[model samples]
Target chain A: MRWRVIGLETHDAYINMALDEAISEGIRTGSSPPTIRFYNWEPGAVSIGYFQGIRDEVNLEVCRELGVDCIRRWTGGGAVYHDSGGELTYSVIAPAGVFPKNIIESYRLICGWIIRGLEILGIEAEFRPVNDILVKDKKISGSAQTRRGGILLQHGTLLYGLDLKTMFSVLNVSRQKITDKMIKSAEERVTCVLMHREAGREEVYEALLKAFTEDKDYGFGAWNRDELVRARELAEKKYKSEEWTFLR
Target chain B: MITHSSRKVKEGKIVKVEVDCEDVIKKLRITGDFFLHPEDVLDDIEKTMVGLKKDVSFETLVIKINDIVKNNDARMIGISPESIAEVLREALK
Candidate 1:
């Protein structure tokens, strides 16, 4: 099936989450086509999994000090630190009926395209079960998905670089686990594109774009006016509000 | 008394359970970073467990949880009925 692709540029955490939800709702109701969008966080952010309690997973003081936004995702998974300068995030909104019915199987199908993208970047990555992309046993990417009303929205981050110190400070890692040796060893468990190649963000983005469009018929598109309006409402009413973010 | 327990399952998926009970379960709140499709099944499970004895057998709890999951057609990934039952047993302990 054909898909519409958009390089959504960068947006803050609330608007980004709102757009994903709004676009998925549009496609679910047949008001828009299935879409693949690439985006980046404006000031970096920490997105906790849907089922997580914000206070339990994040150090809010650290986030505030660093000017990072903290938001909760619509999908269930571990908390992720989206670094503005170190990562690229992409979302795929499609009809759930057109994809695999099994959650894990759909993850594999989507991650396969990311693997191809990594290949073009000269970084060999493998799809680790339950939703992780690994290179030599180090995680390079992680994805999460949610399906509702016949629509599926899957979004994830690809590591271009990692600021381990900042990430550890913002996330809820135990104090006992914070050590030079620990951080050093942690590096062995996570890798990035810059660590392997001399590619910049645009190079990585181009590789992913080529991989997604390669062998498939796709068209460039923009968000519809109604979607922008709905997204703004959702961002202001749901995503940015403490009621929804701290609802747990 | 309010009893609480948290368990980290495979892939670091966490299951945190808090139950209010003295003899029979009065209330339960299950929270964590686990995937459960149509998430409302959590409410159904909590409601079903309200009147259960504090010392309910593990197998019975599992059976009850499975019944709700099946009846609701809920799909749970990373978290399992057994894990939820184990956490419940911990709370009851």
Candidate 2:
């Protein structure tokens, strides 16, 4: 099956999420092809799982001070701090039938591409079940998946660099002191690509693009006019609204 | 009053439950990093919890949730009915 491969692009948090939802709608209606895309958040952002209580997971004061966007995802997962220069995000949307029926099996299949990309960079990584990619037992990437109306949407983040201070400040880690011990403990569990190699973000993106498209029928593509319009509307009406952001 | 409890399940996800109850459960909210396909199944599960006795037995909660899962053909990863039941039990305490 032919897939649309969108190269790494940058957008604010709302528009980024809106585009994914829009594409999913398009795919369900047979207007869009199966797609795999890479992107970066601008001004950075903090995203919480659909079921999470945002006030419990995000430090809104810190986010406002730093001008970071905080939004609740349509998918369930832990809160994530997406740093513009420190992370790379990818999404795959296709009919559920194209992938394994078992959820973990599907994660392994999609996460395998990330593992392959890490290998290409000479960085060995493994897929930790339920959506995580780890290098030497330290997490380097995390993903979340949600299936709606027969189209399965899986999106995740690949850390390229570390910014523990900012990440912690924005992620409601206020109950604990932000000290050396905290950073040390976090560094032990979380990691990024730069920690393993010196590849620039552009090089990493190319490697990931190659790994994701390898042996698959896909081509570089762009969003259609209708998708852009829909995304803009969703961004303004849904993602940017208080009702959705504050939803638990 | 609202009672809350949270735990990191051995299955590898954080499960946090907040329940509003006096005698019968008036409200229940389950939040976590766990995965649930066709995610709205969670809403259904929470809805089922409403009107249940606050002192609902662990086994009863499991049966209630499992029935909903089977009915909806829902799939959960990094979490299970037993784990959610355990959290709900703790919140009741």
Candidate 3:
């Protein structure tokens, strides 16, 4: 089967997420081929899982003060602080029949591509069960998936850099004081490509693309007019609506 | 009246369950960041909980929860039926 690879582009949180749903719907109905998209967030954002309460998961006051966008994802998992220029996000939308039917097994199968991508960058990474990729005992990536109709959409982040202080500030951390030890522990837990070596953005992007396309039949593709229209409509009607973001 | 409680499980997942009962459970709503297979299984589990006796024992609740999850082939990542039952037990108090 031939896969469609949509190259990297940066957009606001609403549009990027809207496109994922719209494209997945196209794949579901056979209007478009299964696709893999690479993208980035422009002004930074915080995306919480589908069922998570934004108030409970995020420091909304800080987010507002800093002009960071906050939204809810269509998939289930923990909250994530997606910093602009700090992360590379990828989405894979395919027919459910193309992957394992079991939830856990499918997560392992899809996350393997992420590990392979890290390997292409000369980084050794391992898949930690249930949707995390670890490099030397520290998390380098996390993914989440959701299945609807006949399509499966999985999207996640691969850190190129991380602003630990900014991230902890936006995310809810019950501790009154974030001690030096706390920061040290966080650094020990999360890692980014920048911490390993100096690498250009394009180089990292190419390595990821190579890892994703290895041993697979794929070619560059663009969203059709119909897909773009649907995405815009969904963005306005669903994703951008306050009711949807705070529905939980 | 409905009673609700939430717990932050060890895995950083939240398990929030709400129960409405007078003598029997009139409603149940389960909401959280936990992943459940097939996605809609939460609705099924909620439906199953409703109409159950309010005084249902912890052991019985656990067995019922396990049966529901197993029968649906539902896998709860970062959250477990035991953790859910713990919340329910606390709400009952």
Candidate 4:
């Protein structure tokens, strides 16, 4: 099967999540091919899982003060703070039948591409069960997946940099003041590409793009008009609405 | 009263429960980092908690959740019916 590969593009939180959902819908109806896209979040953002409580996971006041956008994801997972230049996010949307029916096995298969990508940078990482990629026991990446209407959509982030202070500020880790010790504690459990090797963001993206496309029949592609139209609609109507954001 | 509790289950996921109740659960909300496929099954899980006595047994809660989960063929990753039940019971307390 041929796969569509879209290179890195920048968008806000709402558009990023909306595009994934939109692509899933397209793939479900056979209007679009299986797709693998990499993207960046601009102005930064904090995204909580679908079932997550916004108040429990994000500090909206802090986010607004910091000029960061906050939104909920369509998939289930922990909350993530996507810094503009701190991470590279990727999404794989295709028919559910194309992958293993077992969730863990499928996560392992898709996350393997990440492990290979990191390997190209000389950073050896391992996939932790459910949905995490760790380097030396510290998390370097995380993903979430949701299968619907015969389509499976999995999107995740690969940490390129660390901004624990801003990340902690936006996320509701605690009500206490941000402290060096707190950041230090998080550093022990989290990691990024910069922590492992010296490489530019473009180089890392290229490495990932290569690994993801390896052994697969894929070609560079772009979203069609239908996908763009649907994504914008979902971004404005569903993702940005108070009802969806506060669904919890 | 709105009672709330959260638990970091053994499987490394957090499960939070918010309940409004007197003698029986009036409303319940389950939220956290856990993954539940066919996510709408959450509605059924929350619905099952409603009208349950404040003193409902953990076993009973798990059974109620398991029935819905099994019937829907839903998959709960990083969490289980028992874990959700425990947090719900804790919130009621």
User: In candidate 3, what are the lDDT values of residues A42-95, reduced to their tens digit?
Assistant: 899999888677887799999999989998888888788999999999999999
lDDT (Cα, tens digit) per residue for candidate 1, span A54-119: 887899999999999999988888788999989999999999987899999999999888999999
Ranking by lDDT: 4, 2, 1, 3
Q: In angstroms, what RMSD does candidate 1 have relative to the true structure?
A: 2.7
Error of 1 at A64 (Å): 1.6
Residue A189 of model 3: what lDDT?
75
Q: Can you write out model 3's per-residue Cα lDDT over B1-93, one digit (the tens) per residue?
A: 789887776655678777888888898777776787667677777787788788888887788889999998777887888888888877766
Query: Residue A71's C-alpha lDDT in candidate 1?
Result: 95
List runs of model 4 lying over 4 Å from the truth: A174-184
Tens digits of per-residue lDDT for model 2 on B1-93? 899988777687778899999989999899877888878999999999999987899999999999999999998888899999999999998
How well does candidate 4 score on lDDT at residue A166?
95
Residue A128 lDDT, candidate 4, scale 0-100: 95
Instruction: Return the top candidate by DockQ.
Output: 4
lDDT of 4 at B62: 94
Assess each model's interface with DockQ, reporting 2 decimals per model.
Answer: 0.50, 0.56, 0.41, 0.62
Cα displacement (Å) at residue A33, model 3: 0.7
lDDT values for all models: 0.87, 0.90, 0.84, 0.92
lDDT of 2 by residue, A154-222 (tens): 999999999999998998752222242245455477899999999999989988999999999998899
The deviation in Å at residue A19 for candidate 3 is: 1.1
Quote the lDDT for A246 in model 2: 83
Candidate 3 Cα RMSD (Å)? 3.4
